[model samples]
Target: MSEKKPSLLEGFKAFLMRGNVIDLAVAVVIGAAFTNIVNAVVKGVINPLVGAFGTKNLDSYSSCLKAPCEVGPDGEMQGIQIMWGSVLGATLQFLITAAVVYFLMVLPMARYLARREAQRKAKEGVQETLEVTELEVLKEIRDALVAQRAGGNAGPEGSPAPGDRG
Candidate 1:
C-alpha cells in the first residue's frame, strides 16, 4: 500500500492550527495593544513628572559634541549633538514594559504551570498505585485458579474424575 503525503497548503494549515502557534499569535497581538497603553502612560504621567525637573519633551535635551553647534535658516544642525534625554526616555519605557510583562504575565504563568504539573504528578501517582493493586489482585486470582486445578484432578487427557461414570 502507498501512503499519501500532505500538500503544502495542508501542512501550513496544520501548522497554523497548532496550539502554540495560535497562542503566540494572540500574545503578539496583546503585546502590541499593551505597548500602546505603556506609551500613553509614559507620555501622560512619566513625561510630566520628568518635566518638573526639566523640559516636558525628552528630545529637546541634548549636549553639544563639537563646537559651533548652530542651526541653519532651514532648521538644520551644523555640528554633532548628543540627545541623551531621548535615550533615557526609551530606556525607561523598556524597563517599564519588561517589569510589567514579567510580574503580571510571566510570573503568574509560571506559577500556574507549576500547579498544573504538581496536579498531574499527583494523579499519575494514584494511577500507578491502582495499577499495582490491580496487578497484585490478578496474580492472586491466577494462583488460586492454579491451586484449585492442581487439588482437583480428572486424570490424564481424555479421562474423567474418579466419581464420574464414563
Candidate 2:
C-alpha cells in the first residue's frame, strides 16, 4: 500500500483563498501601513508641537539623581539609573495613538455601522408595515366571514345603521 502526501502548494492555495484569511491578510497590511503613518505624524508634527511647549520631545521630561551613587572598585554604579523619561514618552505615545485611532478610525467606523443599521431597519420597517396591513385585511375578512356564518349584517345585534349608531 502506498500513502499519498498532501501537497504544500495546495494547502497554501486553500489557505490564501479562504475568505476570512484573505480579509485578515489585508487588515494586517493596512494596519502596518497605518502604524507607520501614525508614527510619522507623532514624530514629525505632534512631537514638535509638544516640544514647543517646553516638554522636550516627551523623552527628556525626567529628572536625574543629582548625587550619583557610590561605584564599586571596578567603576560600575551601585544604584540603578531610572529611565522614567522613556516610560513617560511611551505613555504619551500610547495616549496619542489611542486618541487618533479612536477619533479617526473607530468613531467613524461606529458611525458608519450605525447608519447602515438604521437604513436596514428602515427597509425592514417597510416590510413590517406591509405585513401589518395584510394582517389587518385578513382580520377584517375573518370578521366578515364570521358575521356571514351567523346570518347577521356583520354588525352588533339590534344596532342601528352607521348614521344612526350614535
So what's the TM-score on candidate 2?
Answer: 0.66
Residues 60-143, candidate 1: write the lDDT tens digits.
889999866889788999889988999989998998889988999999999999999999999999999999999999999999
Worst 10 residues of 2 by lDDT: 157-166
Model 2 gets an lDDT of: 0.78
The local lDDT score (0 to 100) that residue 99 gets in candidate 2 is: 91
- Report the poorest 10 consecutive residues by lDDT, candidate 1: 155-164
RMSD in angstroms, all models? 7.1, 7.6
Clash list (residue pairs), candidate 2: none
